[model samples]
Target: MASVQKETIIDADPADVWAVIGDFIDGPTRMAPGFVTNSRLEEPEVRIVTFADGTVAHERLIARDDQTRRIVYSVVGGTMHPTHDNASMQVFPHSEGRSRFVWIRDMQPDDLAIEVGAGMGHGLSVFKQTMESPR
Candidate 1:
């Protein structure tokens, strides 16, 4: 499997970041407003999201741990090469009122690494900006 991991220091409280990320359905659209244009909940653990770049993906929630501030999901169907893809996002206390945000994706077909990595990079950048911006 091809894996990509991206981490960033978010200038916000870990709980605040988790609150945004833990929503599962409305989370992406609200947390990264522009990056994720729309999100529709198909079920309690499934969502369909449309991205800023006009890509659509169907994702299923794998696990969400409130105590650990972590969420795990898998791309069941998508425009991207998805032989198999599983992703996880976790938030940890970094410092006073700051959080360490980590996003990781594991997918098949190594050739798609560049595309997935770039998308993740942009998403993380947007997430940081959105989380740190005045609410």
Candidate 2:
């Protein structure tokens, strides 16, 4: 499996960041508005998201831990044909009122790595700005 990992420091509290990132349904759009055009909950833990490129993806929420400020999910179906796609995001307290956000994705067929890694890089950059900007 190929994996992509990204980390960023946001000038916000961990809980504050988690509050937005943890909301599986609306989080993507709110956390990375330009990248994720739309996100809606299909079921309790399933979500259908529309990307900026107009590609739609169905993801299932695997786990959410408030205490650890972490969330895990899998891409069940999407434009890309990957044998497997699992991703996770976690937030850690960096300093006074600052947070470190980490995003990781594991997929098969190694070729998927470049696309996912690039997406995560852009997503994380936007996420950091969205989180640090005035609320």
Candidate 3:
């Protein structure tokens, strides 16, 4: 499997970041507003996500740890047909009023890692911008 990891420091409190990202059903759309246009729960552990690019993905929640501020999910069905896809995002306290965001994705077929990584990079940028903006 190919693994891709992306991390960034957000100029926001860890608790604040967790409050947005910890929401499994609405987190993506909330964190990266335009990037993730919409997200709705289909089941207790499953959600349908729609991206700004008009791509849709059916994701299954694997685990969510509020204590650790981490969420794990897998892409069960999506526009991109990957053999396997598992992703996790975690938030950690950084400076006095800042937080660290880390995203890691593991997927089959090394070639797909490039595209996935690029998307992740953009997503992180959007997330950071959103988190730092005034509420």
Candidate 4:
């Protein structure tokens, strides 16, 4: 199984980042507009997030720890043409004023580094910038 981990430092406070992270359906509401066009919250911690590429993903918020500022999401069920099964994303907070967001898993049909890299790289940057951006 291949693992990809990346980190970025944001100027925003932990709480600020947490707030953005908790946005759930509107996580990208405060992002750099045109990035996350639309996001619809579904039943039972599920959400259908629409991206700029017109790509939509049905994700599930399986776990969330307010005390730890952690959130776990998975794309086991989505609207993608091929759909991503057995995939997940975790967002947690650490440090005085920082957060640790990770996307790790052995989603089937491995060996797609380029595709994964692009998504991860862009997702991290966008999430970081959105969280750090002044309110």
C-alpha TM-score for every candidate: 0.96, 0.97, 0.97, 0.75
Report lDDT (Cα) of residue 103, candidate 2: 93
* Predicted candidate 1 versus true structure: per-residue lDDT over 1-135, tens digit per residue: 899999999999999999988989999997788889999998778999999999999999999999999999999986765898999999999999999999999998887788999988988898999988897
Greater-lDDT candidate between 2 and 3: 3
Stretch of 10 with least lDDT, candidate 1? 76-85
- Clashes (backbone N, CA, C under 3 Å), per candidate, total 0, 0, 0, 0
Q: Write the per-residue lDDT of candidate 4 for residues 1-135, one digit (tens) a residue.
A: 445556666666666766666666777545435666777787868888777877677777777666665566766455453334434344455676766665554444456445656766787778777666666
Using lDDT as the measure, what is the rank order of every candidate, best first? 3, 2, 1, 4
CA lDDT of 114 in candidate 3?
A: 97
What does candidate 2's lDDT look like per residue over 1-135, in tens digits?
Answer: 999999999999999999988999999998999899999988878999998988788999999999999999999986877899999999999999999999999999899899889988988999999988886
Query: Model 3 Cα displacement at 62 (Å)?
Result: 0.5
Error of 1 at 83 (Å): 0.6
Of the candidates shown, which would achieve the greatest lDDT relative to the real structure? 3
Query: Over all chains combined, what TM-score does candidate 1 have?
Result: 0.96
RMSD of each: 0.9, 0.9, 0.8, 2.9
10 residues in a row with least lDDT, candidate 3: 76-85
| Alpha-carbon shift of residue 26 in model 4 (angstroms) | 1.7
